[model samples]
Every structure is written in C-alpha cells, then in structure tokens.
Target: MGNMSKELLREYIKEQNFTNANDILNGLKEMFRDVLQEALEAEMDEALGYRKYDGIEKTNNNSRNGYSKKTVKTELGPVQVNIPRDRNGEFEPRIVPKYQ
Candidate 1:
C-alpha cells in the first residue's frame, strides 16, 4: 500500500534480527548500481557529443548517433560515463560515474 520508509524498514529488521533483509538490500543495491551505471553512461555519452556507437565504448542501443568519452564529477569523485547521441548530431554526456 504505502511506501515503507528506510528508517522504518531498518528498525523492523533490527528488531527481528532478519539477516534476510540485509541480503535483499544488498541485492537491490547491486541492481540499482547496474541500472544506474547504464543510465549514467548513456547520459555521459550524449554529453560528450557522441555520434556513433563504437565497440570500444559502451553506447545505448537507443542512441542512433555516436558517443565520446566524458569525465563526470560525482559526490564520490570523478566518474566517467558514456552518453548517448542521436544521428542528428546530438549528444550530451553526463557528469557521473557509471555504477557497476
């Protein structure tokens, strides 16, 4: 029904000693990291004004054009993402690291 807050979830797990919760969280974290990485890479590719997809680089299939390497700044530090680009000479790489 309603979204469970992080604090609530933490407290519930702590009280129950539910190790499963940690596993689930770890799994989710992995999934999120992968998805986030792909998204950020795509964005970075676009920002770099990429025009085509190169085997050397990770480019989104949705991108019709190519892409270029970009350096993105993040809270953790500098992250490089491959932004997507359009065939119409449009590409904007993002300034974020590609998550695992």
Candidate 2:
C-alpha cells in the first residue's frame, strides 16, 4: 500500500472527485485509521513474538488469543480497532493502550 494512496489520489484528481475540504479530510481520516490498525497488528506480533497464523513451533507458553473490538477516539474521528489478545492477557498495546 506504499503508492496505492498516491494512485488513488491521482485518480480522484483526474475525476475531479473531491468537491470540498470535507471529502479530503474524510479520506485522510480513513487512511489514518488504516495506518493505526496496521501498527496495532505489528505491535501485537512483537508482543506475541509471532506473526498471525505462523506455523512455527511455539517457543514460549504464551500465544495469541484473539481480537477484541475497541473504539478509540482520534483527531479525525472515532475509529474502531481490533485489539489483539494473548493467552496470558499480558499484552498491553502502546498504540491504543488498554484503558484508553
């Protein structure tokens, strides 16, 4: 997704899609949410010491439990994120935080 956003923006400009500032703002908000979600997933991988669905043998006892829906307030708006969980319940996400 490196240049995907730029390509989309080019298409939008070619079609004259954005009529006002709100449209651009909304697009940026959506992009921000996507980036935040990706970061959260990466953080989970680091905390768990494994990527999602990896077939490698478990090095430690802790493992990925699942995900929990979490709505977080951002500068753009409220974005719902899938917070990852560990079996030991010791994974504290620094991106969104547990109590945020």
Q: lDDT per prediction?
A: 0.52, 0.85
- Provide the lDDT at 34 for model 2: 82
Top candidate when judged by lDDT against the true structure:
2
Worst 10 residues of 1 by lDDT: 91-100
Model 2: lDDT of residue 49: 78
* Tens digit per residue, CA lDDT, model 1, 1-100: 1586989867755665546767766544544555656875556455544633465554444445545555555444454444544555544334342232
Tell me the lDDT of candidate 2.
Answer: 0.85
- Alpha-carbon TM-score of each model against the true structure: 0.34, 0.78
Ten-residue region with minimum lDDT total, candidate 2:
9-18
Off by over 4 Å in 1: 1-19, 51-100
Tell me the number of clashing residue pairs for each predicted model. Answer: 26, 0
Compare the candidates by TM-score and give the number of the best one: 2
Relative to the true structure, candidate 1 has a C-alpha RMSD (angstroms) of 10.0
Candidate 1's C-alpha lDDT? 0.52
**Model 1, C-alpha of 92: deviation from truth (Å):** 8.5
